[model samples]
Target: MKIGELARRTGLSASRIRFYEASGLIEARRLGNGYRDYPEDAVQRLEVITCGQQAGFSLEEMRALTLEPTGGANRHERLLASLKGKVVEIEAMQARLAQSRTHLLALIAGIEGKPVDISCEENAQRLLARLRENDEPHSQAT
Candidate 1:
């Protein structure tokens, strides 16, 4: 299929499909006119990638999770370890999210009650700091 057909079938923009190709998440061949010609399986791969993204896996992580190397005996053990670690991280994140929600509720109630020495700016800064501290994996990108 051509890029346009793939985009329509996937419900994703052509540019986004191209970007995914550039990111090494999708592969395509060049047609006679130099347009991208995607294989039939590309649509399925795109669907899987989209599903993984919705489930919070980065492209790199998704690639690792989808690896199909020739019969590695330790694959199950590695996947188990990765999933277990992710579960623990997710649990910790849930706790932090609950705490943040509680804190935000308190802040809202305090503001509604006309707290004397508190300002919205100060509260916002505090909340932002708490969020950054609790965010997973300490990204250097931001």
Candidate 2:
């Protein structure tokens, strides 16, 4: 099939398909008439690339997984290691996000809990003081 047909089949733009080819993610053969010809399996390959991208895999990472020929024995082990590493990274990010949410909630509570009689300027100053205090390192009790 032609590049246009492949693009239509993959629901990707022609330029994106060409870019993938340029990025070494997929290949096309040139016909004598200078038209690009793609194998039927290219559709499946494009789907894999799309899925990998949606799963947060970088182009280079996708290329490694899809294009690189791993010896039959270690392929499973390598894939497992990569997936485990991604899980760990995602967990660490989740931890940081949770901490951030906690901190923001605390700040919101502090702002809302301020006495009604206090002026906005006074509340701002109090919030600044609280932020600065949080920034300071606390001494650990032995």
Candidate 3:
């Protein structure tokens, strides 16, 4: 079918389909009239590409999975290994985000606990001091 039909069937824009083609994710044949002709299997391939993208697979990774020769034996194992690695990376990112949240909450608490009796400039100075203290490296008592 034509690119327009393929776009409608895949629920993707024609430009996106064209991008996938240019990215080497999909293939199309040029007819005698210079119009692109796509095979029926292209629809399923596009679906797989979409699913991979949703799973956080980069275009390079997707290309590796979809285009590499796997010897037809360990494809599932490879995919599982890749997924496990991604989980570990995501967990590390979550840990950093949690630390960031804790630090932000502490800063907010410090700001809110400032003495109301002090001038605004004094309060600001105290906050700056608190931030500087937090930025300093404390020596652990061994």
Candidate 4:
């Protein structure tokens, strides 16, 4: 099929397909008429590329997984490791976000619980001390 057909089938633009080809993520053969021809399997390859990108894989990482040789063994093992590593990174990010959220909620509660009798300067000092005490944002979410 041609670039247009591939783009329609993949829901990607022709330029994106060309960019992938240029970036060595996919390949196309040139016909005698100066047109690019693609095999049926190219559709599957493009799907995998897009899906990998959606799953947080960079173009370079996608290129490595799809292009690099893994010694003819169960190539899937390398892919599996990469997927697991990404999951770990995502989990760590989730933990950090959870802690940050807890810190924000704590600050909000402290502000709302301020004693009306206290002067502004004293209230600020109290908040400041509270902030200093919880500076790490390490509070665990229940």
Best by lDDT: 4
What stretches of model 1 exceed 4 Å from their correct place? 70-84, 114-142
- Tell me the alpha-carbon RMSD of every candidate: 8.1, 2.5, 2.8, 4.4
True-structure RMSD for candidate 2: 2.5
* Candidate 3 residue-wise lDDT at 133: 78
Q: Distance (Å) between predicted and true CA of 99, model 4?
A: 1.4
> Which model scores highest in TM-score?
2
Q: What does candidate 4's lDDT look like per residue over 1-142, in tens digits?
A: 9999999999999999999999988889999999999999889989999999999999999998988764665678888899999999889999999988987887788778889999867887888788777774566633
Task: Please give the ranking of all candidate structures by TM-score, highest first, separated by commas.
Answer: 2, 3, 4, 1
Candidate 3, after superposition: displacement of residue 21 in Å? 0.8
- Residue 84 lDDT in candidate 3: 89
> How far off is residue 20 in model 1, in Å?
0.9
lDDT of all predictions: 0.79, 0.86, 0.86, 0.89
TM-score of 3: 0.79
Rank candidates by lDDT, best first.
4, 3, 2, 1
In model 3, the Cα lDDT at residue 121 comes to 77
lDDT for each residue of candidate 2 in 21-129, tens digit (9 for 90 to 100): 9998889999999999999989998998898788667898888788868467577777777678777878999999997897789779878898899987898788888
Q: Number of clashes in every candidate structure?
A: 0, 0, 0, 0
TM-scores, all candidates, are 0.68, 0.80, 0.79, 0.77
* lDDT over C-alpha atoms for residue 20 of model 1: 88
